[model samples]
Target chain A: MKRLKKVGLIAVVCLSLVACQGGVPKEALELSPESLQQRQTQTRRFDTNNEAKLLTSGAQVLQDLGFTVEDSETKLGMIAASKDRDATETGQVVGAILLAILTKQAQAIDDKQKISVSLITRPISAKETLVRVTFQRVVWNTRGQVSKTEPLDDPKLYQDFFAKLSESVFLTANEI
Target chain B: MTNTVKKTACAALVVLLLAGCQTDSRDQVLATSESQVALRSIQSRVFDTTDKAKTQRTIIATLQDLGFVIDKADATLGTVSATKLNGYAMRMTVSVRDHGTKQTLVRASAQYNQTAIEDPLPYQQFFTALEKAMFLTAHDAD
Candidate 1:
């Protein structure tokens, strides 16, 4: 009976969450100053104008990162890839266990996460091509419910990805 | 068991009451307060250039600039789908086709989480951003 009440409470909380959500936020479609900064962070330019070559190298880098290609349009110079990885942390597990022991109820720990990436290449001119990549992730808890769905905006992540991509481009250019 | 059943029933009623019951949930599958033509006018625009490839690329760039991660894009079909996740998910699909010999039609439809975004103001904001990127005026597709 107590468990039933808990379920009801959870349902009510979820109902309130759904009810309170408004339409798309006002700034959702509008461009902001940070957009420029993010674009700079997510984009890099290569001296080679061969857009196809850049796309190929980008795919290779994603593969090296343990991501599986999901979609690509060579004509448009776009590639999408994703990887399913373990999201469990020892600290989170320990905390969950402690809370469960105190409350006599099991707490859901983070279990799995899927990180998705999109890569796009644009030609700036006859000699320059710009490659941009963005990443987002969906995390599920041990309960198999989505816990977090958000874009990954760590500048270092983008930097690391581009660094690998740059090396891949160089190696591919040299026929390595 | 009856006591538990009674409590469950009461809780379900509370859930319904808290939801406000503005619209019937069953009707959501095909429900639209706006007319089809009205929605079409709000979601579509015509550009003077017939360069579908360039227009699609510009749309991709605009979506990226608006903080969307591209999901899929098909040049042959002239469709690009992307999702923006900033605490919430906003999925948008932009399709480009020829309006005539000299004009290209670009239509974008977006859904915020589960609800379709039929609002005209948001669509206007989108076209404004897109036009700035394309360097072309967006003619209302009336």
Candidate 2:
């Protein structure tokens, strides 16, 4: 009986303690941009070769497909160009040019992830360009097997990831 | 004798009640702290990709298509750093790392508040949308 009484007493004490605490902490779940930037700066090591390789390969591919490759050497994975003289016709031609490249690359990757290749042309206040057709390619890779997959095994995922990157810049260069 | 005994019992009861309340509060706080830790563990797993570089490349492409030039971009285990071009009102960043290796898929979410967002410009929007798109890419959009 005495032991039972002691245990009961302990239980009561525990409950009382819980009722006194305050609300959530001010910075409990929030992240500041600075912290984010710091973390990235600390971790992200840039490889000029990686960026350069991708850019060169992309430009070469674009030229092989017959689109004029402006700025053979682009900095920081960016390429820009003025709009083609025959805007819509040129856009269609570029899209077709990209389609052939994408089809071949997608087959090579044998990827199962969904690839979203979007083309949007937002006006640059330069001229009669209704929309600047900027291309983007994305693959979900839900299995999250990107870094895990070898360049040979899931070449499509890697290829697609870079395909859009290269093509997006490819189009931008035309617009510049 | 009876009045004195009653007063002592009442005082003792108050002391016991207060102590019980204190213990309860302590346990709750401890439990909450533990849960928060667990949540963070889960969140980190959101970025558990075998290759973060490949993931970032795909996301960057999508962002470019959406008309936002990536300003500052980086990637790690389950996280990405990116800024939209022209200083658009949206910023896109996400952590795809989560804790559990084989159990829960999402590791950590940098864009938890963006689960409900529909905009295509923000990183969250692009991230989630890309997730859906990735599913299709992986499956070959049959």
Best by DockQ: 1
What DockQ does model 2 achieve?
0.04
Q: Per-residue CA lDDT of candidate 2, range A1-176, in tens? A: 67447656765665566444333222222233443332222111212224444445445544443444332212224332112221124454466568768786421122232111112222223342111122222222223332111111133433453445445444322212
DockQ for each candidate? 0.49, 0.04
Docking class for model 2 is incorrect
- lDDT against the true structure, per candidate, is 0.88, 0.35
- Candidate 1 overall Cα lDDT vs. reference? 0.88
lDDT of 1 at A131: 86
lDDT of 2 by residue, B13-123 (tens): 666666643445445433433355544443332333444444544454444433333333334343333322221123345444322442213322332121212221232
C-alpha positional error of residue A67 in candidate 1 after TM-score superposition, expressed in Å: 1.2
Give the clashing pairs for model 1: none
